[model samples]
Target: MTIKEQYVAAKQAYANWGIDVDAALETLKKVPISIHCWQGDDIGGFEVNKSELSGGIDITGNYPGKATTPEELRMDLEKALSLIPGKHRVNLHAIYAETNGEAVERDQLEPKHFENWLNWAKENGLGLDFNPTLFSHEKAADGLTLSHPNEEIREFWINHCIASRKIGEYFGRELGNPCLTNIWIPDGYKDIPSDRLTPRKRLKESLDRIFTAEVDETCNWDAVESKVFGIGSESYVVGSHEFYLGYALKNNKICLVDTGHYHPTETVSNKISSMLLYSDKLALHVSRPVRWDSDHVVILDDELREIALEIVRNDALNQVIIGLDFFDASINRVAAWTIGTRNMIKALLYALLVPNDHLKELQEKGDFTERLALMEEFKTYPFGAIWDYYCEKMNVPVKERWLTLVKEYEHDVLAKR
Candidate 1:
């Protein structure tokens, strides 16, 4: 049978086993995935579709960064969105902050900026994730000198809140918005652990203030409170622990788990299970094995990609939003993201083929051993036929484009090492 036929057959089998095949397919289709395309020398302006492989490496050579005029950015985004299908979104960091990383010195979401971004995205049918860091994760531990014990960090964080509100307002003015802000803070320790309690307290305080501001004051307040996620640089990083999440829960925040940020030994499925158990807000960061570094590249079995999908099937968690959190220095950022997303889709399909009855029976009996065994079974189960099937049905051209992307960029990425 053709690949599409195999996919139909496998999906049919899943449906017969009481799985919501249509829902699964829809969720698989609409997972909000994007890459971090920062303003840099490699990519000066924006080449949205072409950068799907290497994250738009050097595509905008000699072009101004965010220093470009608002009209310029709007024009860049307009052209970029027209090339890519669907409402393509990006996770961009705010360049406005005086933090260590590069930031836009321009006003935070000036009226002109918002009007242009809004009109262009609306006209062209696109979206922006606007993932910004409040207290730069890179500086949280070592840059204690830049902040105060209580007052300074609060001030910096609240400033982020103000900036966030302004940006959201600017965007919402154009499109009726959902999820006005995307926050991923590295507010954890790196070395010589500080008073863990203090960090949690400060973070909670900061979030409480932000939430109040967003709900009580902001114009388009449809922010997904649960999409707020944290990552610790190390395993013991403050935000990586349970207490930080507990405090977030107290203030109505959810956990977003990045696959690479967990301790190297932590499997994706286990993390998903733990995060699901403890939190109502669920978001996922998908990336591949980086050996030592986090957010390396995207590979299906590089770590626990298969099992992560199984957790989705077993838990049947539908409210979760899966997004791409890929950062690459040497290779093209967009290419890595596109390949990573496709790999994720392939893994999702494999998870779908695993008989739902088998998974349900194990869960119903409280059979941890049996459930894990079935999950492992699904992890290695062969569904190439099904994968090929969906590729044809969706006209995704998985093999050719995937191979071309991998072949062209994989060597470049490896050579940079």
Candidate 2:
């Protein structure tokens, strides 16, 4: 069938199934796009070249060296950003100020590296997805202990945040842009029972510091919207994230949702919906699924592809930032990164084309089972259709369309077989 015919067939099939096809496709088109650094190590020579899938590797380890030489990082980032397709960029890494042979510091990233990075991003016609402070596994394993949460850890966290603020100044004044910062708290309870209020209090105090800087100094968006990081595999107790969200909203800070951080038992769609319901001010840290690890893979699963698209389409939250949280070693292929990113974009377009009315109806009447059923049914309809639609929308040539179709068909067959 022709591409248009295929879209029509898919639409008609959905209609036959009592779902609104047009509304589903329409919702898929409105999401924003971004670039992330999942493959930095590959480019940096830490990982073997053959294992590198993308041009770079993820700075996933506790290497204090990553942030020490800001100039080296800037050159590498410039090279990577030159490869991206758009004008906006976002990156997440655990960087420190220590030199090449220095011992890794827990929270020792020099704020200047971030400033240089932001400056580079601005110069390169890209925006920033600046995840200023990330956590290490050691910290995750051994939760940060504070004798007086209000006095000690709070101060340390604030100092780190101030460093981030100093970087924000460059974005606001020098770059004429804003940096997107996400605070993913790795400080959860260890084996022992801890006072939830203390950690929460510490988080709030730290956030207050960041926001105070944001409000007082620079005009970057990151300052005003304190991105609250919550509930990693190790950090949060059962209700810690929910409480954090409540607290952040109460204090005018935004909840930054990382796709892979939640427990396997939690429904991501529900969590996203809940966050959106509270306030439109939000940020997203996107990645793939994992049982224990926060595998920063480009989202490719059919189900998750749809959910990610929906998050962008349902832009109730005015500020939506797309993040590729994948961090692999250097031996991986750059082609894989391109394909994964393209697939994500394709899925988003498909979601946008989906009829919003169908989602609304399903949401209105769907119980748990019905909702799952609806999501499953409505998922692929738009993704496939939109993929085809976008090629045409972009004015792809007929020959290119045929080649793409052949590849997609081959992929689908292999996936099924």
Candidate 3:
């Protein structure tokens, strides 16, 4: 059957539940998912004196056709963007700065180093986001930054974060959109620590100094992300969720929640509604974590749909900032981004097609039986029909057709590389 014909039938099914499929599609088009740049090159950013990937982060498998240069990475990203629906943003780490073969230290970085990225973003009409690389560096060799015992080491990271915020401000001003400069540090102990308060206190002081540098809020906003544990810091992590949650609330900064940064039983979907109660805005790194904090490619799973439902049902579409964060060297990198991003958008589409208001009313009236039945029945509804129509309307390849183009690019462009 034609895509439009399928959509027409699906629209009527949702309409019976008082759901407006057309309005839902319009809302979905405006949600921009920030695609992480590190996925294209396995987080190996272009730097003159690059350090080994450290701080408990690991990327397995040696995928062929990994982009080796700044231009190539950007080219690969553009390819992935074309396959995904909706206008989106690109997320960058500090190490991705281009300095023309110059050995610019982290603290010495400026906006000029990212001029190429800014120009590419402008020409393509995409928004930009930023993050300070607090891991995989000499200063963080001990697996601690900001919370380091040595004053000199902590000072270096503080300056680097300050420099990164200024660069984020530049992107916001030039692009006419506020850039989210997020900070995620890996500062923890491999074994149980004798004292935790000391490190957290030092970390708090470092953040205060970094924010004191004074960048205009109109151009840039700040966010703090926390992790439960990592490779070396299994026993303890300085930037725990509670630590950053309190800090963000007191400091008036956005608190970022990485889906993979929680415990095995803990779920990010459950925390979204509560976080929204205290703050007007929140940021997310929507990633699939397998077992531990292993950054796996996202899929349309139960948790992903619940997360999307929380955002759409609560009417927090503009309140929550969504971004993708996962890297796998086993598959095609471009295809990895396309699949992960498409699934995220697909989850949002699925949630939008649900009868959220009706479900809530049923719960309010204590009609648990009907609520459970209706939700289950909606699962078998025609969600795929609407998604296929969205792809056709957005002018992207429908269904699995995008993989064909990826194969052609692999043989023609990536094979030579």
- Per lDDT, the best of the predicted structures is 3
lDDT of 3 by residue, 279-389 (tens): 989999999999999999999999999999999999999999999899999999999999999999999999999999999999999999999999999999999999999
Q: In candidate 1, how many Å is residue 270 off?
A: 1.7
- What is the alpha-carbon lDDT of model 1 when measured against the actual structure? 0.49
Query: How many clashes does each candidate structure show, in the order listed?
Result: 22, 40, 0
lDDT values for all models: 0.49, 0.49, 0.96
Once fitted onto the true fold, the runs of candidate 3 whose alpha carbons sit more than 4 angstroms away are: none
lDDT of 3 at 364: 100
* Candidate 2 local lDDT, 1-417, one digit each (tens): 788887777667656656455554444434435556535333232111112221111334432222113454454344433333334455544342323444434345554545555556656766655444423333223334221244655565565656555554555565555555555545554344456576656566566666676432334445222212233323344224566577567876666666655666554556666667776566665566565333545655764655655675576524555655555432222333444455566555545444555567777875557667766666655446645654464443332334454345334432232
Which structure among the candidates has the greatest TM-score? Answer: 3
Ranking by lDDT: 3, 2, 1
RMSD of 2: 8.5
| Candidates ranked by TM-score | 3, 1, 2
